[model samples]
Each structure stands twice: as C-alpha cells, then as structure tokens.
Target: MAASALISPAIHAVRSASAIVCKEVIDSHVLRIDGYSRLKHMMHGKYIRSGDFHAGGHAWRLLYYPNGSQLQFQDHIAVYLQLASRDPNDEQVLARPRFSLLDQLGNPALPHDCGMHRFSY
Candidate 1:
C-alpha cells in the first residue's frame, strides 16, 4: 500500500504598535509513503518522520504512523506535527496544524480530512 498526506501549518502572529494587530502565515508540505503496507507491519506504535521543513520561521516535521499511536486505535492511522527547531529560551511555538489524506490524483480527499488543531511546543 502507498499513501500520501498534506500537512499545513497556520501560524498566528500578534504585533503590538499603537494598536495590536494580528497576521497569519500559512505553509504546507506533502509527505509520500511509498511502502506503506510494509511500514504498517514493521512499525506499530513507532512513527516515520519527515525531513525538516520550515514555516513561520520555525522548523517542523510530520510524524506519520502506519497504525494508530495507541493500541486501542491500531486499526486507524495517525499523523502529528512536531516542532523541530530549538529555542535558547525554550519559548513555546504556536501553530494550527491540518492533516489531509490525498486522493489518487493528489487532491485532498474531502470529508476524510482532519480538523486543524492548536499545537504549542
């Protein structure tokens, strides 16, 4: 089996001048799994991570699980966004991460997409 996914990051920034203002920066990356069936059998709870990608001045990666992260949900697949960059002060990084399964034609599989989750790291 083979699978593909799109991971999009939406970063929210707040700027304070005479008045406070907010902005958003959106970026995305595609992750392709060539041998998903083999991975599912070989890697259970463990995950395959994507190479470092950048968004909103921070480095990020996608954690793909062939099976679920936990035993109870083993029948399902899971994906997570991880912060790959390290800050000297260990400041938290905030982002809204969206995960979508791609169709055979490389478009998003509607209704099969995961909702955006607020992530802080």
Candidate 2:
C-alpha cells in the first residue's frame, strides 16, 4: 500500500548483486580472476569487468608475417571458460597454459606490446 513496500524487492536485488562482485589486480600487467568473475569486453567501450583472472608470471607477445605488416586483430583475446574449485584429494593436474612473444627484425608490427613476439594457436 506504500511506496517503500513496492520498492523493497528492487533494493534487495541490487544489494545481492553487489555482495557477489569480486576483482583483483596483483601485478602491474597481471590479473587474478576469482570464482565470481564475469566480463564483457569492448574495443573502445566502457570496461565490463571480468570477475577474476590469473596473470602472475604471465606475459603477452606479438605475431608477424613473411611480407611484413603486423597481424591485425579485432578481438585481442576473448575466451570463456567455466572452471570449478579444485579438490585437495584430486592430484595430477596439468600446468597452466603458456604465452610467448618474439621481436621482429623487420616487417609486421607486434601485438600485445611486447618488444618482440611469436604467437601460436
């Protein structure tokens, strides 16, 4: 019967979503995403957060071609993965994926801002 009563549910939902948000940036060029991370990326749009990511000891690089000219990209790196919490009892897990970069003597610019790089798919 009152305005306060009608608006109670909306306020509750905002609070709920706020409580679940998480983010962290441990290093200058690395990020650690948590279990609650979600992100929507745009080239020149407002940053939609990616909940949590792991970027420790991780580096970025570039790719080149024979005739020269950097490998252009519309989407720098876009991937989606759903992972569960690790189990103490579960052993023999594989190592995290690796990233590499190389420098070019001439032709083709590098991506990822590395001095030089080699990228593999």
Candidate 3:
C-alpha cells in the first residue's frame, strides 16, 4: 500500500479525537538542522531545544537529540515536540498534534501520524 493510504486513517483519527482542524496535511513550520555534527559535540549528552514556533495558535518547539536519551534508543536519533506555551483556562491549548520527519527530498521518513492523545486542558 502507498504511504498516503496508510496515513489517512491516522490523520482522520487525530482530527476526530482532538477536534484539530488543519488547513493542510502537515503544518507549515519546518525545523532544519544544518550543523548537527558540531552541535552535538558542543552540547554533549544534552537535549537541544528550538526557539518557540507557532502551531495551532500556541507556541511549540522541537526537542532534538543528537544522541538518544535512553539506552534503548541510543543508536538512533530521537526528537520530540513540546508544548512551549499554555494557559490554564484555554481549552484548545493542549492538542494531539501529529509529528513526522521529512527527508531532503520531502518524503516522510516515518509514519506521519505519530501521536494521538486526549488533552484535558
């Protein structure tokens, strides 16, 4: 089966679960890593967090790992999306946003829909 065919259900599920309306399949914001070789060496064994970027009307950032954080994923790189800004009173602040890694050719390196959570806030 094609990648798009495989990911359609996941996207639909995220929309239904989070009530998140996306104008596009993936969000427009892209995080590019240029000098990864030197960066990882400089900040050894520590996570690199990006500056705040807007997504779903809230601030979000990419937490990157040059070296994996745990033993299980030590040989592989890991990245996480963190909710950078929040309001206790905001209902739509915490959302189940999908994350994906795109190759240099713009193909998704992994499955598109990686997260599906029901946020109480």
Candidate 4:
C-alpha cells in the first residue's frame, strides 16, 4: 500500500502578483500475511488492520479483509485505507491512495488504484 499528498499553501487573492511554491510528501507501508489461507477461513466481514503510520503529517492505517468485507463478496478480498488521526478543528485531509496485491516475488498481482479522496471525521 502507498499513500501520497500534495501539501500546498492556501491560495489567496493578492494585489501584487507573486509566485507560490508547494511540496509533495509520499509514504508507504506494506502488510505481509504469512498464513493467508488461514485468514481466509475466518468469518466474513472480519478484518485485520495495520498499525498506524504517518504520511503528510497525518496518521493512517490499512484494513485487510481476507474473506471480503461483506457477505456478497466473500469469494474476493478487500482492502481499505482509513484515517487514524483526529483533528481538534475537524479539518479535512486530502490524499491519493493506491493499493496492490503483490505476489511472492514482489510483483503486483492485482491493480487497485484510487483518485483523490477527502478524509474527515
């Protein structure tokens, strides 16, 4: 799993023209399961979550569902990205997340990509 964000300054109307600079921060975390077959035998809708990790100054985690998150998709697997940080001001965080299932040789077994997402309380 990989997460990235562009932390840009808030734009404002100025009487004088000026140049604004912005930077991007990228971070990633990988969760490897040694006994995936055993996990798949667990009850449906059950999930295992990764530990909290930081990306772009925010805490995040990943949820892995071996037997799928719901009964309708029990034959498949599911993964979700969750925001683990709470803001006192209830602000929203923007991030782009990408998930992939890697094979034993460290290659992508499936393609899972997502667009920009807004995360809040």
Candidate 5:
C-alpha cells in the first residue's frame, strides 16, 4: 500500500516495435586504388582502427590481410567488411554489398555481390 511500490512495476513495462525498410542509391562513389601494394593502412594504437568509410548513412570499414587471415593459406589474401557503429534503437539494417577487383586499365577482373543481407547491432 505504498506509492513507491506501485510505480516500480510500471517502470519495467516498456516495449518497442521493429520494422524493415529499404533505401535506393541516387548516386554512387567510386574509390580507385592504384598501386594498391604501396598503400599501407595501419592502426596507430590498440584502440585505433583503419580503413573507415561511409555508406548509406553508416560507418563501415574494409580490412585486408595480404598474407591471408590464417597460417594455412599465406599465399592468398583475406578481406572482410565490418560495421563500425549502429544506432541502439535500430534492430536491423538491410544491406546489399558489392565488391570488385579491377585491372591496371580499370576493367573489372573479379566482381562479387553479396545480395541483400540483414545486419543488426
């Protein structure tokens, strides 16, 4: 029969709804990497990170290891895409990522498209 006890239950009764949406590209940005071997991206310190880029109102990065991710395949290259940050209120984000490796004259030697994937923080 106390005022403080009555308020405690109501404070915990909060809910939120989740929904999905899509965005279209009105324009595009092409980042040309010539002499890619000479480009060195290094994290300055333990807390520092490299290769930060922006796309679709979000921060993203591409990590590349020329010597492969593991010891087994040192001859090959390892690449990955990482989402740097996300809004807490947002539960899911739809993404369609495309990647290409070009030759010296800017022709696509290898192209990859990881069609429509869901990303959540």
Candidate 6:
C-alpha cells in the first residue's frame, strides 16, 4: 500500500475483467515506469524501496519478483531519504514507511527510525 500510494497518480490502477489482465497492464507499467529511462529522471540517486516484510518481506513489485528484490528496494528508498533529508527536497515524496520481515521479530525494527539499527534473532 505504501508503494502504491506513491505510484497511484503517476500510474493508475487499471482494472479488467480478469485479475491476470489487470496485473498484465498495471503491473507491467510499474516495471516500465521504473525502467532505466524513467529511473534516470525520476529516481536519480535517491529513493528507498522497502515493502511489507512482516513475514520477512515479499518481492512483490505489483507482480514482478526477483532475487533479493526486497532488500534492494529497502536500500534504494533509504538512499533517496538520506539525500533528500540533507538537501531541499520534498519529504512528502517519501515512500510511506511500511513493515518488513526485518521487523517481524522479537522487537520492532526501526532501522531508519532509530538510525536503522540491526539486531540478531
């Protein structure tokens, strides 16, 4: 939902007769909009990409998933925040913080919220 919140306007959620169809159109667009050309203009060196990890994170970029995608997204979003936090940038542009498997443990994982700390299970 956090990721969708950021992508909604830029990419409308298309609905179709079949879930497969909707996923085809909507999901592909997510990947395309995130392609190199778009990334060059939109993301630059900033943008952190974390997702619902209450169960250790799922690689659900709408529909696409790959190895380490979860961690990759986290690192990406963090980079953006790190840069924007120090410079004049739009904080609202942030990817609303969401839960991750990283935090679905004994204690809450406030990595960024608390200097992005790490803990062992």
Clashing pairs in 1: none
Q: List residue ranges in candidate 2 displaced over 4 A.
A: 1-72, 92-121
Candidate 4 colliding pairs, count: 0
TM-score, each model?
0.73, 0.17, 0.62, 0.75, 0.56, 0.18
Q: In order, how many clashes per candidate? A: 0, 14, 0, 0, 0, 16
Each prediction's Cα RMSD? 22.7, 19.6, 19.3, 17.5, 12.5, 25.0
* Residue 97 lDDT (model 4): 90
lDDT of 3 by residue, 24-121 (tens): 33355677888977776665567888888976666778788887777676556677777777667675543556656788898767755655654432
- Please provide the root mean square deviation of candidate 5 (C-alpha atoms, Å): 12.5
Q: Which of the numbered candidates is closest to the native, going by highest TM-score?
A: 4
- Decoy 4 TM-score against native: 0.75
TM-score of 1: 0.73
Tens-digit lDDT track for model 4 on 2-118? Answer: 888989999997787778886767777788877888889864678999899888888898888998888898899888899998978668988889888788798877767698899
TM-score of 6: 0.18
lDDT of each: 0.80, 0.31, 0.68, 0.84, 0.61, 0.31
Q: What 10-residue stretch in candidate 2 is worst by lDDT?
A: 61-70
lDDT tens digits, residue span 23-78, model 2? 53333322333331232221232222334433432332222112222235323433
Please list the residue runs of candidate 3 whose C-alpha ends up more than 4 Å from where it truly belongs after superposition.
1-26, 118-121
Error of 5 at 23 (Å): 4.0
lDDT of 6 by residue, 17-100 (tens): 845442211111111223634444454444435332221121222222222135555333222211112223332222333332
Regions more than 4 Å wrong, model 5:
1-21, 26-49
